[model samples]
Target chain A: MTTQTTAQAPARVRLTQLTRGQTARLDSADFKDDSAAHLTAMGLRPSCQLRVCKAGQPCIVHVDGHAGGCRIALSRDLAASLYVLPH
Target chain B: MPPVTLPTNPVSVTVAIRTAALVGNPNVGKSTLFNTLAGLRQKTANFPGTTQEAHLAQVQSPAGPIVLADLPGAYGLSLNTNESRICKGVLTGDQSIKGFPGGKPDAVAIVVDATNVPRNLRLAGEVIALGLPTIVVVTMTDAAARKGIKIDAEKFEAALGCPVVFASGKTGKGVADVLPALARAKVAAGPLSAAHIDEWADAVYAKACTAETRDHDAVTDRLDLAFTHPILGVATFAAIMTGLFWAIFSLATIPMDAIEAGFGWLAGLVSNTLPAGAIRDLLADGVIAGVGGTLVFLPQIVLLFFLIALLEQTGYLARAAFVIDRLLKPFGLPGHAFVPLLSGHACAIPAIMSARAIPDFRQRVATILAIPFMSCSARIPVYVLLTQILFPESTMLQAVAFTGCYVLGAAAGLFTAIIARRTILKGKSPAMALELPRYQWPSLLGATKTAAARGWLFVRKAGTVILAISVILWWLSAYPKPADPDDAQRAAEVSFLGRIGGAVQPVFAPMGADRQLTVGILASFAAREVFVSTMAVQIAGTDDAEGEGVRERLTEATRDDGTKVFTPATSWAMLVFFVLAIQCLPTLVVTAKEAGGWKWAALQAGWMTGVAYVAATIVYGVASAIG
Candidate 1:
């Protein structure tokens, strides 16, 4: 999933670097234990497109995918763990 | 991914009565649908060994009477959370979990949110792979329509190899189809492997659902901007909390006063009808007064729950949690602790039970330990008496003192949480990852049902214990009656309770409390509000004679040496004491059960009493020095 989207992007940066309203594709996520699996189950898989709604500690993001989009709020620590490629 | 075990007998028709479990993610309208389907036949129950609560209801289906288990919502059946564990256990027929109607449910009803179908589909797939007779109930159809999302149930049903039913719990639409669907439920075709479940869900969702160019919800975005703003959010929370509490206190007064007056009248009737003796006294004071004291708070409890349900239904509660998370993180509490702590202001029994919402055990224990320190409604009568005594001439000072009591209690609770987290329960707070459900108008009927259930639960769970303790205290005080029964003070002096108070008088001597004050303090352990009536009996020989008369007599009452009993220092000490003391027995029992150990309850009681004793002594010393 990551190769399909990241192959087309010129640059990748941490999710925290994305500003409000910026769209990006999730490249990968680094979480301890089952946190990564839990995030994936909530529809934040690699290659899933997301748009930053509120960019800060406890940031809000809209995860858009083929199935439809849902809004989620992530704490600062969680937001810092995700790597995303700007669309 | 964890290995998913598919149940062998998904369509087991061997059981005499069939059972089905309602499974879904949190905020998917599952609860609402359950309540609608099983109206008045449901009861909230705790899953064995865990603090998680689920509702079980029996509904009559076209095929037979089916018992519906409303399992706690989870993100997936394989997650580490208690919700997921319980869901998995029940679905897989884990017989070790007792108290469930059926050891393992015969079927599973997977509720999927229409608006957020993609996110909900993974859980649905997991349930389907269990090979259980399953039906996908697509809820929030009305909300989905408003969002310009359409779900083709035929395509979804065909794609998943199960019947798909669209329902809107809010509008009572498609609810009638649930039972019928459950009757005709069938296990889906070959199970999807654990690794491929997510892929299968996404593919199914794509084929069956279409969205009309979804745009950002402008109203929600604007509301979130103000609600989640740092300074603005805090101010809004404060204002909203103030309004909530103010409404509870003010609106509940009428019903509270009525309950009190009704019981007072009952006590009077008991006294007048019975021949004046131990029976009359027991009926009037021990039974009527004892039970009524606890029942009077029912209005406050009901009102608090009703208001909270409304707030939660509006989806603002998630934003509130997000905002409060910032403040509570430093104290080592997760944002989820907000509701339980807020509920503690009304009563600690329910508040402690509500702590099950905290997923982490250590965090839940910390929250439960800190809850009793909040100034519960039980302490109001004591506060009213003490603040008035402290500021006899000025209402402004009394009001300030009253507010200070709440502030002091809240500060003590928070500080205790901080200290506990740093010392015994040491861990960094877990980062919150919450899905903010879309906002909607709250259901008044649902709020009413919740308030009714909570209010009744309080009475049912705590009522007997309170009555039993009050009766015991009455026996201790009424026994060994003096020769002159007419003299209430002399009888009290000779009774077991009075002698016990004399024995404990020295312990409180440093706080300027005499035998009479000591007796009042000891009696208040039954319930804080009992202090007023106990003082009336101890000092004035009758509790029925209420008002300024009793207050004046108590204020002017003298010790054996003719010194005033209620000294300035003693009033201040007692005020601080009530604010910090763990006086309610039901709260301790609940803490023990909910925290899963007597040691935690002992720790909570010991720590709180120690704090109260030391704080009260210090207050006494300072007041004496100032005077």
Candidate 2:
């Protein structure tokens, strides 16, 4: 199920729903403290486009172009906490 | 107090030295920058409130030679871990927390990954708001250029209100410019609130760097697919670990043997030079041999660190951690424990020290506690002694038995950690977000420096503690000597250790250990390999075999009842006990320091001892029945 505030404003989808090879834009993350601060610091911010290189509870992501971009691993807990809009 | 206060001189204040701190996210080339700046002149010490050690160095700049403190990599001001919080305190100049010489940095070099502009800019914005003199060091420009992304430093600086330098540690490109930028660093006012900080970073990045482009990288994608394929990832991780150990064993054996021989020759010289007295014995047996025994494992430690540095440099470590995290998380051990756990095969001291990199408190402790059970290189000799006793001439049997010890030790480590995580060090396993740095050539000089530091700290910090315990053990075994002696065993029987061994013999009788074996076990508490030397003295008169090795004569050594000492059940039981036991006092000392206090150390020692005894007893019962 996908929820959208409006067509132009990005549809809301759980980050876990995005599989490997799928690119998505991060809308918001539902975290408060360490996890939130950590994710934000790692560049999983709203409006930032990221592609899933590998998907699982702990997903691997490459921001921007897959070649020269920063590749980071996120834990399942972090994955579930994120809200994304897939492209 | 009032009467004594009159003589107090004016408080002498030491002039504060200007210092810069290197701060950034992990795998963002922060360390490379630090190493490039500091070279081999770096010092590491634990920051207050956490086990994470801070690296400080003195690097020359045009402005002056400023002290550089490489603070732990962190995202923003505050985080859950004590490490990140300590970093926050350092940046905020919280006088209550100790980090730098002046309680805060004069300037901070924010090493940003150039490819991740927005994210790096986000951190840059937050730091700029702190009002510290800061410079944005854009690293990996060479790699960034390959993807058609160009970083305009002037535009970035103009927008962010600070200096920005496009540098690559790999190529040493624009590093000189960084020092000057750092010299002229000044905190530019940032957005007032967190919400606006994002907007500010987005706006600045838009003007400063090329727009984001999304496309598949065939090489990286193929590598990722191969490395992270669920089943293949596990297999790859295991294969890599096997390769690591194989390299450690094969590459380190030559140096290990040389160290052993060198120490033996030194001990021989000391023994011959001095008269046959307590002084000679103390110098040769107590001091040289005791210290040399622990130092013998240094080669393995250095090699392990060197290889781990290579793995981290290649970016495969992050993937390895991710793949293993799936297996570890269910056990309540986080993925990051892999480095410490893997390194434990070399030695536990370095393993415990490296556990500081783990961000989560309970997870780090769990890894620390579990490390000693990883069957380090020190336990190899003891394994050989027991295995040889059981399967005298069969090389295949000995090899098989050796492999079993490793498997059993790993199983024990995992089992104990799982139980501890669930029961004592109870906390939800925090999600770990590890950055996969771009694969590049591992820096040999940097790795060597790191290995040297770890080895130096091992000897300098834990060495004295081990030497002290060795001296005490030596004294206990040497004291209350009879006026004359015919055989070493007879001499030992009349000694203080002999009496103590007799007193404790009944406790170990179920494991088929005689009093002398009990004494060996007691001495082994200092270190595992010491058991072989001690057993040689108590079982046979000559502790040092020289030309004729102990291996040939050990099979013929017997107990007092004329019963053959190397019984199958007893050898296997002792082997099992040695496999599981916490025999290294130095490991305990390090754990005490690393795990915060002696409380956790005491628990670890007591529990491991208790478990080893029970497991050994069971092995003895079953083996005796089968035999």
Candidate 3:
């Protein structure tokens, strides 16, 4: 077997850019002082992952493993205010 | 800072405590909880600037006298929707808007459904964030237990740093504890720290929520499959509506007949006992006939309310909204507007008030404007008379045509709503965020009590306003009697009101209504049902010995040119016009009160009258052409 080399990670982008069905690994403190307070109250936190279920108009995001993953509906304006790191 | 000590009173002093505001999401048993706390002392009044009324009551608690205001249920304080904004302003002491005209509450009793803790907690978190003293009253605990959902109240209270009371409004269990807890509580001066809420939400969910081993996915999937299916859902909605209207018509006929018979018998008894003078004529023609005609509709109104209440309680109303939302979108109305529009068919007053459920300003206005277009039950008497005159030989066809009048009215309402929304009431359609409450077997007692209370209120209003108008109409047609029995017909034609109708008759000649019908239409402006009574009085005044009833006299009415006045074309056009017209003064007054001023009501009335004039003109033109 040929030896494999590790690749460098891409730069972090805004949380709102995450596409539908994509999961994000976020830092809880990144959301602490930001507009992410709403997201955190909805069970999205640092070290927690969220899957984007829908990405248009009123975006629907699913929080992983909390109460069988609750669906959070956010207006486009509110969704654009979030920031998250890609997994 | 110094620690101050207060002097003790010589005698025992009891300070009266103020009332608490009950706040919660829609359908979380807040109303039931308010009923428990207030009991029979409850009073409801309309909220300022909005038609939605908040219920208030005084509670005599052991601590002191506390009053409770049942604020309209809302989802979140952050949302800008009308209902949510009202709740937010009340809770946050931001009363710039006049929708809620009271001061902020001393404390809030936050109601939550224990069965749906996750969704309920979201609302609780928002309320707690307001920094007011709050007690979480977890309702539906009994339902939750049956559904295998367990909530640890202690854990929840510890997490939120507030008291949590487990209560069931249905069973009245643990409800007494809420007021006492609220009586002794002090409100926090500032909002909960954002850091604290984050920690609290995470800890509470982690500790209180247990992993579900059973799969509910299948159940939800099947429900979605059926409920959201376009073909089946629309079919089911149509079938249900058809059945409801059919039952309203069929079931109400028995009581209506009984009421009519009772009134006729009373009229006969009074006529035989008293002399044939003004008093006898007033009692028989004015009071009995007028009041009886209005009261005869009570059974139908009550039956309609009963079905609506049952549908609301069983949560089927949401599905209706879901279906109608798609259908009504093109009409420039939201889906939830369906309830208000449907309620308008019974009465525009309640229908206008119900428009508060719509969040967007434009949508609400559109709904309000369209409500008067619905063929309210007030128009039924006029339609029946016109149909009888037009289709005397075909009763079944007339009945069908009467129903078609209702359909035509609804179409006119939808068309107007669309035009208004596109021009004057233009705005983006608000997002649909309605929660689908779980279906339950509707309570028979609850439905009956609601229907009875509403029906009685309608009768009370009729007694006050309609009774006064009927007596006035009778008085107007009674005076200036013919000088002689030989010249009676000529004198009637020369009477002041008869001259008025005759002057107006030329204006309505194109529509084929003679002076008698013209007078009826003019009288209906004061009260819609007066059309029937006005015609009766006019017919009775003209003929001396015929002794024929108003219905028979109307059948023999003819125009000045000796042609039948009640032709199918003219009668149908008149029926259609009444169905489309905004003719009730009381409805206009109520609309003014609900809409915050006379300007909006005037605009609505003027536009609706114009629409009626144009539509009636078209109908008359086409029908005359065809005939």
Q: Model 2 over residues B138-244: C-alpha lDDT tens digits?
A: 88776677767777777777776777787776667788887767777866776666777777776776666774554457677667767766888889988998998
Q: Each candidate's lDDT (Cα)?
A: 0.82, 0.78, 0.68
Answer with 1 or 3, whichever has the higher TM-score: 1
Taking the tens digit of each residue's C-alpha lDDT, what string does model 1 give over B540-588? 8887535887888877778868988778898999999999988787788
Q: Which candidate is the best by DockQ?
A: 1
Arrange candidates by TM-score, highest first: which order?
1, 2, 3
Rank by lDDT, highest first. Answer: 1, 2, 3
Which has the higher lDDT value, candidate number 2 or candidate number 3?
A: 2
Local lDDT at B606 for model 2: 94
Per-residue lDDT over B1-627 for candidate 3, one digit per residue giving the tens place of the 0 to 100 score: 112111121121123347567888778888878876776677666566665567778787677777677888875566555567777877787643232235677778889776556555666767777767777788887656655566676666655556678776667899888887775453322224544433444455555555443213434334433554567767877787778777777888899999999998998999999997889978987788768867887787788778878888886766566566777888889877887787787767666755766767788888888998898877887887888778778999889989899899899899889889889888667544344566677877667866776687668767877677767766665556676634544544665667778888887777667887787787777567767666665654543222336676777767667777677777877887798888886677666766667887898888887887777778888998898
Taking all chains together, the TM-score of candidate 3 against the true structure is 0.78
Top-scoring candidate (TM-score): 1
TM-score of each model's chain B? 0.92, 0.89, 0.83
TM-score per candidate, chains pooled: 0.92, 0.89, 0.78
In angstroms, the error of model 3 at B163 is 2.7
Span of 10 residues, lowest total lDDT, candidate 1 chain B: B1-10
